[model samples]
Target: MRKLTAGLFHSIDGVVEAPNLFQFDSFDDDLGALLTGVLGRVDTVLMGRVGYEQWAGYWPNAQVDDDFASFINGVPKHVASDTLTAPLAWQNAQLIEGELLAFVKKLKQAEGGEISAMGGISLVRQLLFAGLLDELTLMTHPVIAGTGRHLFEPGDPTTRLTLVDSQQTAKGNVVSTYARRD
Candidate 1:
């Protein structure tokens, strides 16, 4: 079964929105290696409509002779959007049909390496709450944003997660990996 993993860039105070507003230190080789390793494990990219639109508009034009650009542009992108349709403007992008939960469940059962979801907090919350996420990885920066949209919504049920691994990047970002406790 393919594992559904949520990889998010979060601020110190748990803000997952508008990552560009957060203070990002220099991306040294350590951070590069870390991101490369994370991207290497996933065969598919999952995202919501808004994130898909943003990424589709940007990544198609940002391609370079690099692993990230190549992987992002070349890999299959499954967008969970009720409004979007294909042929999607971005290469290899497809709109997910039927019920979202059912689609994700079927995707997990399919033969694949791993599925990764990034950004689009609403979709991430839905996947996490539906118990479809097998792993959650947060690359948390050191500075506090004080106010913004948080990763966990208010009134969410308590879900225990077991920490699988953690490492600090040279830029002081903490990369923490967690597995959902069944």
Candidate 2:
């Protein structure tokens, strides 16, 4: 089965949102290669309702390199939200309803490519609780968000995460890759 990797940029306080308020931890090209590597292997992206809204509002018109632009523009996005309607801003996007776990499990086992979730706190929590997350690729910034939406809430669940890879950049960014124990 393909892995479900959730790559997040967070503070020591576990805040994932509004990271732009903090100084970027990445130097000129320190972690660009790593991000590019992950994006290169992405076949599909799964996002929660909030993440979908944010991404739908931002990425479509961002002026960036053609490769990065194409990756976001062309990738298929599966958003788990019943409130959202069809005909979203991004191409090849859908709002999936019903048991999110079962749906994602089938998607992971399907005869296709890798699925990744970035900056989806609620979805991350759900997956974390279900132990559906295969790997967590985190880039921790030096700055901390004193207040914002935290990545971990009241779940208080125990999950296995084995560090398979890690690296730190001169820009005060530490990148780590963790695999699920199961």
Candidate 3:
């Protein structure tokens, strides 16, 4: 079965939204290597409407020399959106058919490389709680983002996860990977 995974640029205070605002200072070569490794393992990308739209607007037209531009532009993207229609403008992107969770469940059964849930906070949360996401990696930057949306909010159901791997980058970013405890 294909593994479904998600990685987030997180802050010490748990903020996962808009890492671009706070992560650049600590984004070092080690962190870049980590992300590149993850990208290498992933052949399919999954994202919500917001991330899809945001990336579609940029990556496709971004300079070819950009590290992520070619990879993101070429990879197959499946977008989960209630409002978006088929034949998305982005190359290799398409709206998901049927129920989101059901579609993911079936996709997991299909033979393929790793399926990555990219930069979609809501989608990652849903997948983690629904037990669909096989792994979650948090590249926790050493900073306190005082105001931003967090990946886990108050009143969310308790979910137990086992740490599978962790490392501290030279620039003080802590990369941690976890798997749900079944």
Query: Which number leads on lDDT?
Result: 3
The digit string of per-residue lDDT tens for model 2 on 145-172 reads 7988877777576777799999887776
Task: Give Cα distance to truth, residue 151, candidate 3, Å.
Answer: 0.3
Model 2 residue pairs with clashes: none
RMSD of 1: 1.4
Clash counts per candidate, in order, are 0, 0, 0
In order of TM-score, best first, we have 3, 1, 2
Highest-scoring model, TM-score? 3
Candidate 2 is scored at a TM of 0.91
* Model 3 lDDT per residue over 24-51, tens place: 6899999999998988999999999999
What is the C-alpha lDDT profile of model 1 across 6-123, one tens digit per residue?
A: 8888888999887778856644577679888878898998989999888788877884886777889999988988898777888898888889899999889999888998647899
Which candidate order results from sorting by lDDT in descending order?
3, 1, 2
TM-score of 3: 0.98
